[model samples]
Target: MERIKIHFAYDGTDFAGYQVQLEKRTVQLVIEQALAKIHRQDIKVFTSGRTDSGVHAIDQVIHFNTPLTLDCSAWRNALQTLLPIDIQIKHVEKVDESFHARKSAKEKIYRYQIINQREYDLFKRMYEWHVIKPINIDQVKIAAKRIEGTHDFTAFSASKSNVKGDKTRTIHAIDVLEEFGRIVIEVRGDGFLTHMVRIIVGTLVEIGIGRRDQSCIDRAFATLDRQVVGLTAPSHGLYLWKVVY
Candidate 1:
């Protein structure tokens, strides 16, 4: 079988999520439908990971096997003609059969956006988490620093997440930056559990607003309890910013 690799981006607002459900609209379902139109058969695709409902992915990677031979450009254009406007085919290429999208990924960067101002901006309503209270950027920075290295992040993930086994993941860096009336939190990590990045943002936001302190991060880790952690941030504000292989 010939393996083809694809790099794609999606708005993720109108769809259910990345993975296909029985009836719900999804990125995978639409892509596969488009592939079916071209290949004249069902084509199974494997993604790096599934994004929750309303979660956006800027560069979601996937790989699929095909029996027919077609150039990279031909595949890209053909898929685009069948896909909806919300999804875009960024790049496509033929890859070695050994390259598995999920297993081969080395890093992923997630971005969460929050509007720190009190008044809400109608234009940014759908894309950002609007925070009415004042946030101390310095406090947010302090908490971000504490969890920069490797640790078992069991406390920072959704308890009901289907992903099981080791909760240990290395966080390469977390940068808290303010720009254009919004606060952006970017986390680079080797891997993430369900709602992992959203949970991290929620924890930091709590500290910035004085509801929690840096100690909570430690307590959550030491106890390995989700109850010690902050609420999971809204899904719309989170984005799978990048994936590195």
Candidate 2:
């Protein structure tokens, strides 16, 4: 058997999530089915990470072991023909047998977009979180700066999560930019807990709207309590931007 790495992107509007579910459409399931058809064997995929329901990905990576020997481009194009319109296989390459996508990843970046205007963009409704009220980008940055180091992120993660690791993770950066009536929050971390990025965005949104002070972020980090943070922003606005190895 040979190991191959694949890079892909998908719009997660219809799928349940990246992981396979009992009876729901998923990015992993679709790819696994396509691989099974092409290889004529049971092919399993190991992903860089998981995204929640309605969350999209731009450069998600995965690896699989296959018995067939085929050109890398042929493998990519053939899988694209089998996948749905929302999912696209971007590239394929042969890799060392020990290359595990998730384990080899050094960090992951996720971006959340918010439409900060009165009227929503119809085509972008399913891709962003819309906020009618005005938001102060500077205030969001102030809150963002408070959480930019190795700290326990329990306050910014969903109460019910299956993430297994030390809660203390390093956040390399949290950047907030406003452009074209949209607010973008980019977070890069070594790893993330389930819904952690969305919750961090929600906490910053509260600070931007004057509902919470920037100091509250410090308190939340010090306490490591989930109740200290705000709501988890909707999944639609979140995207797995990239995975760094």
Candidate 2 Cα outliers beyond 4 Å, as residue runs: none
* Model 1: residues with Cα > 4 Å off, grouped in runs: none
What tens digits encode model 2's per-residue C-alpha lDDT throughout 1-245? 88999999999999999999999998989989998899878788999988989999999999998888888998988999998999978889999977899999999999999998889899999999998878898889988988889998888888877766678889999999876768999999999988889999999998889887888788888898888888899999999999998
Model 1 lDDT, residue 85, Cα: 96
State each model's CA lDDT, in order. Answer: 0.91, 0.90
- Over 92-115, each residue of candidate 1 has an lDDT whose tens digit, in order, gives 989998899999999999999999
Models, CA RMSD each: 1.1, 1.0
* Lowest-sum lDDT 10-residue window in model 1: 117-126
lDDT of 2: 0.90
lDDT of 1: 0.91
To one decimal, what is the Cα RMSD in angstroms of model 2 from the true structure? Answer: 1.0
Q: What is the TM-score of each candidate against the true structure?
A: 0.97, 0.97
